[model samples]
Target: MSDLGLDDLAAELADFAPAKKKQATYTAREERIIAGFEDIERFYEEHGRLPQHGEDRDIFERLHAVRLDRLRELEDCRTLLAGLDKHALLDRAAVVSMDEDDLDPDDLMAELSGLGEGDDITTLRHVRSAEEKRAAEEVARRDKCHDFEKFEPLFKQVKDDLANGSRITRPFELKAEIRPGAFFIVFGQICYVAEMGEVFTNPQGRTDARLRVIFDNKTESGMLMRSLQRQLNEDDAGRRITDPAPGPLFADKADDGEAETGTIYVLRSKSDHPVVAEHREVMHKIGVTSGSVEARISGAEKSSTYLLAGVEIVATYKVYGVNCQKLESLMHKVFASAQINLSIPDRFGHMVKPREWFLVPLHVVDEAVERIRDRSILDWVYDPNAGRLVEA
Candidate 1:
C-alpha cells in the first residue's frame, strides 16, 4: 500500500491527465470571412478610413462596403472578425439597407437576379429588335486581339493606300458574304473583318455571322454580318475596300491597231548621287505600261518623275488586258514605306517630287507583281527587314 509499481503509477497519471484537443481546420465559409476581414483591414490601413458605399464611391470600395455589411449580419462572421477590428470598423454605424427609394429599379433587379455573378439571365428582359438582338450577340462574342501589333502597321498601310488612291472603295454588294480578312468601309470608316463567327440565323430568319471589325483608327468592334450589311445599305457612304490594282498606264499599238498588253517594269537609276549610289541595289522605280520600256524611260534625265536620272530597265513582265495604271499604283503602294523621297529639278527649274521611286530591291518588286497577278497581294506585304514578302 505504501509503494506503487511502474504500471500502476502510469495508469494513475493517464487517468488524471487532461485530454489533448484536435487542431482546428477552417471551413470554406470561415475562410471567406477571414479573407474578407483581411481585405477590410488592408483597406483601413491604406486609407485610414472604412470603405463606404454610394454611386460616387469607387467600385472596389463599394464592394468592400457590401462585404462588410454581409459580415456584420452574420454572427459567426462577427465572432471571427472580433479580434481583427483594431480599426474599430465593427463599432461603426450599421449599413443602411437599400430600398426601392435608394436604388434604381434596374439596379434592384440586377442585385436580386445575381446578374453580376455571371449568371445568364438575358431572357428576363423584354424582347429585343432584330438589330438590337444582333448587337447584343456581337457584344457577347467580343474577343481580344492577342497580336494586334502585327496587324497595326498593315491597317495603317491600308488607310494610307486608301487616302492616296492606291486602294479603291466600291459599293458593298448585298450578295457578297461577309468573310474573315475582308475589308469594308462603313460610315466612312474603313473596317477590316479580322475574324468571323459561325453561321446562324437572325431573328428575321436571315443567315448572319459575327465579325471582329477593326477600324483604321485602332478602335475595334464586334458586329453582326446583317447589322453591318444594314449599315452599309443605310449609310450610302459605305463601301467595300479593294486592294491596289496598279495594272498598266500607257498603251502601244499592235499590228491589228488594238492596244498591246502591258508590262510591270522595274528600272535602276544610273545616277551618281550619294543617296542613289548608297542604296543602288534597293533604289529602283516600279511602273506598269503597255508601251516600250525604252520609250517610257526615254529622256528620263529631263523628268522629275525619273529623278532627273537615266534609268536602265532592270526587269519586265508581260501581262494581258489588266489595268496597267492600277498595277503601277499597286507597286508604288506595296513599296510605299521604302519610297525614295527625292526632290529633283525639272526642265522648268522647279523642284518636283518623284513618287514612283522606291528604295526596294528588284526581287521584291517581282514578288509583288506576281502576287498582284494571282490576286494574293492583298494578303501579303514586303517585309523590308526580312528582305522577303510575308503574309499580312
Candidate 2:
C-alpha cells in the first residue's frame, strides 16, 4: 500500500481534504475605517489621553473624538480592532458628547450595514467616509472683498490693539462667537466677520449661516459660520481677539452693555532702571480704576509707583459683576510669586516701593484675567519658572 502510486494517493487526499480556505482581507472601505481609528491611536500615543469631543477642541481632535466614540459603540469596529486595542482604547468612556446632527447620516448607515464602498447596488461611484467629506470641507472658500477698503482699517486697528496688548487673544471656541463685527485670528490672519447672512437650517437639521469674513490681506471669504468655526478650531494658533472689556456688569440702573464700572490696565515702564530695561518683556504694572485708563496714567513719569517714567499701556480687561478692586486684588494674590520689587524715589526724593508691578509676561496676565472671569483664580497660583498658572 505504501508503494502504491504516490500521484493516485495525493489526488485522493486532495479531493478528501476540505477546500483550502482563503485568508480574510479587508475591503478598501473597511481598511479606511480602521485607518481612521489608527489615527486616534497615534494621537493617544502622542498626547497620552483619549481625544475628547467639544467644539472648543481642535478640529482634527474633534474628528478623532467622533471616530473614537464610534469605535466604542459600534460592534463591528470593536470586534475588528479588539486585538489592536493594546491601550484599552475601546474601553474608555464613550460618552463624549458630539454634535452629530450636522454629520452626514449616510456615514452611520454605511457603518451599520457593514458594507464596503464597492457593495453599492446602484452606482459604482466611490463613497467617501465622513472624515473624508469633512477633510474636503475644511478648505474654506474665499472670494474677493469688493469693499476691502472699509475693512482694511479695522484689521490694522486689531493688529495694533493686539500688538500693544490693549486687546488680547483667546482660544477660538464656538460658532456663536463668529457674529458680525467679531475679529478672529485664523491661520495667523485677521478674520473680521463683516456681515452675517440670514440663519438657515441645512438638510442635516443643523443651524447655519453664511458669513462675509474679511481677511487681513484684503482678501475675503464667503464661508459658512460653522466652516469658520471648524477652521479656527482645527488650527493650533487660531484665536479670538476680545473686544475691550466692558465696565462693571453689576452696576445699579445699568442698561444692557452699560454695566461696566471699571477697566483693568497693564502698563510697561519706560524707566531707565536696569532691571526694568533688562526684563521689559516680562515686567508689567497691573491696576484697576473706575475711570479712563488714559486719565489714570496722565502723570505717570512724576510718580514712583509708575517707576518714575512714562508708561505704555499694554493690556486692559473690563470688569462686569465683580468689584474692580477685588478682581485686581485677586490677580495680585495669584501672581504674588512673580511680584516685582522696585524701590524708586518720588518727586520729593523719598524712596518708595511699588507693589502692583509684576515680573510676569503679558500672556500670563491674560490667563489671570480669564481665571478671574471664570471664578477659578482662587484655586490657582502663578509659577514664574514655568511661566504659567497652576493649581494652588
Winning model by lDDT: 2
For residue 171, model 2's alpha carbon misses the true position, in angstroms, by 39
Give a tens-digit lDDT track for model 1, residues 308-373.
678888898876655554566567667767777776655556555666677777777767766765
Predicted structure 2: lDDT:
0.67
lDDT of 2 at 354: 67
In model 2, residue pairs whose N, Cα or C atoms come closer than 3 Å (at least 3 residues apart or on different chains), thus clashing, are: 247-260, 247-261, 248-259, 248-260, 248-261, 249-320
lDDT of each: 0.61, 0.67
- Per-model root-mean-square deviation over C-alphas: 24.0, 19.9
- What is candidate 1's TM-score against the reference? 0.35
Residue range 258-352, candidate 2, lDDT tens digits: 55667889999999899999999889988777668887777777665677689999988776544454456667788889888777665656555
- Once superposed on the true structure, which residue ranges of model 2 sit more than 4 Å away at CA? 1-258
Q: How many backbone clashes does candidate 2 have?
A: 6
